[model samples]
Target: MTRRSATLAVAGALIVALVAVASFFNLPYVVYSPGPVEDTLGEWNGQQVIRVDGADTFPTEGVLDLTTVGVTSADAELDLLTALRAWLDPDRAVVPRELVYPEGTTAEQSRQQNAAMLANSQQNAEVAALRKLGYDVPEKVVVDAVVEGAPADGVLEPGDVVVSVDGTPVAAPEDVVDAVTAHEPGETVQFVVDRDGEQLTEDITTIAADDDGRALVGFQPTPGFDLPVDIQIGIDDRIGGPSAGMIFAVAIYDTLTPGALLDGKHIAGTGEITADGEVGPIGGIQQKIAAANHDGAELFLAPASNCDEAVEGNNGDMRVVPVETLDDAVTTIESFVAGDTEDLASCPAS
Candidate 1:
């Protein structure tokens, strides 16, 4: 072969190697895709998603699914080929890695943030649901149960609201525990409680716990609001983030009240709920909407602030309704069930 032919062949080989490297190299971006859609009104592993004790739960009909989005984890590597595929797919999205995992964020830090958001979301969901039903759930550290033949049996009652322990202000159940554990076994701890609007002071002798050897007050302290009923929100622990807050509140309300909230119609939604029943926008709304659409939801509840993006991408197979609060969600569901969907708040088309 001539020298020119040999040079051209070598250049071609180098180009091929570069292309191969580009296809296999990790990219500084993440892909967003549809994830699992869970029915809030249904059960997971034979356990109800929303468990209610000390309250009557009626038989609920139809579906209330909470949507999720699948995204590349902070620790996961994304190649150029994968990013190209995602960019080509209309249902999926490719975003900068910093937009998702953020700069200087570790995988463990991302997981911890998600876990914290999930916990706060659940607490807010419980409070919003109960308060929407006209039940006042005050924020306080209340005695839930007193152990029989234990240190607090005679001194503390189930309905007593713990004000303070040993003169320290009690903001949460942990506060009471810290105060009690500060004392050694067999030590008396002073507690001030409000019983039926009447304040009273009592002293309870601490006992050593068999499991951890920690001092025990013999009463179960609930850190959240003084809920009248025992409300347990159970879902897949693998699910993280606050996007399911509105759906959870709606499902809990449906379980505690009479008549079906969905009326046999399937629905899905995503939002971050506050203690005041306000719904906030969440990330990956487009991906969540796609998941809901793929799961055959007849209606979708969207945070009012997310209307633009939700309408732009999600399949119009399901009606996307904008809701600003839990009250708006309830109203939207009721209207959808009543066949009065004409006047409901809707997202403008993109």
Candidate 2:
């Protein structure tokens, strides 16, 4: 072989080795891509997504789709090549791994936390929908967890139904917090709880929070509501997160009331909703937008705080409207159906 040909072969061999090494080098980063988008008004896994029993349900048209972003598992290792590919792809993103998996958090722990958040989101969505339809949702504060080595560690166990605090009837978790903070750090607070059909009274001392001087009982309280009707959502077990709460609430409210909310127009949305109908921002708005557009969504509902990112991610074909509450979303739907889109709020231009 010629001398130049031999040197060229050796350089090509070195390039191949470098590429092979780069593909195997792991990085502390994860990729975000378009995930599955479910139509809450339709069926999933051959089952109705939303079932409303003991209450009147109206016929829903079109789709009230909830969009999700595909994320890597907490413990999944990503190589340099994978990260670079995602970064170069317009529909994908490369973000720090710690954003999804916190420090010292295991993959199993992340799954459990996501599952718990999904459960809470379902409950809050139902409550918001019921309240939107002018139904009262009475709540009771229950002991969710007791901090270890805290003042209420032994006295207040998880699953205890709180009846009253210091002779005052408490209906919500905020009421209990208010009562606890009403007293000084070392003051004793009496709690009446119902455990397994047995009513018991216990007095626990409070401790001062390090950052704030407010008194704390060192126990987490979860609100248990007395829902007027049963609303079951058949979401796949594989999907978990609080981002779907707003879409769920809209679907539930539409199911219970008369007329269709979507009006045969395809719409997609994502937001974390509160019991009182407040909408909150979520991560991976760009990937979700790409998924919705790919699925041919005509319109999208974006949380007000996520407007900038949502706008930047838009493909210019689908219209993205910003919503601050569930009511705002309903109004946007109504206006869109009526063809009065001039006054509808949208994200600023990129």
For 1-350, candidate 2 gives per-residue lDDT tens digits of 99999999999999999989998898989899989999999997887899988898899999888999888888789998889889889889999988888888888898888888988999999999999999999888989999999999989889898999999999989999999999999999999999988999999999998899889989999998879999899988878889999999999988888898788999999999999999999998888888898899888898999998875584458888899999998999999988999999877622
Model 2 TM-score on a 0 to 1 scale = 0.89
Per-residue CA lDDT of model 1 for 222-299, tens digit only, reads 755767778888888778899899999999999989999888999999999997899999988888888888899989
Candidate 2 lDDT score relative to the true structure: 0.90
RMSD of each: 8.4, 2.8
Which pairs in model 1 have colliding backbones? none
Q: Which candidate leads the pack in lDDT?
A: 2
Instruction: Please tell me which predicted candidate would have the highest TM-score against the true structure.
Output: 2
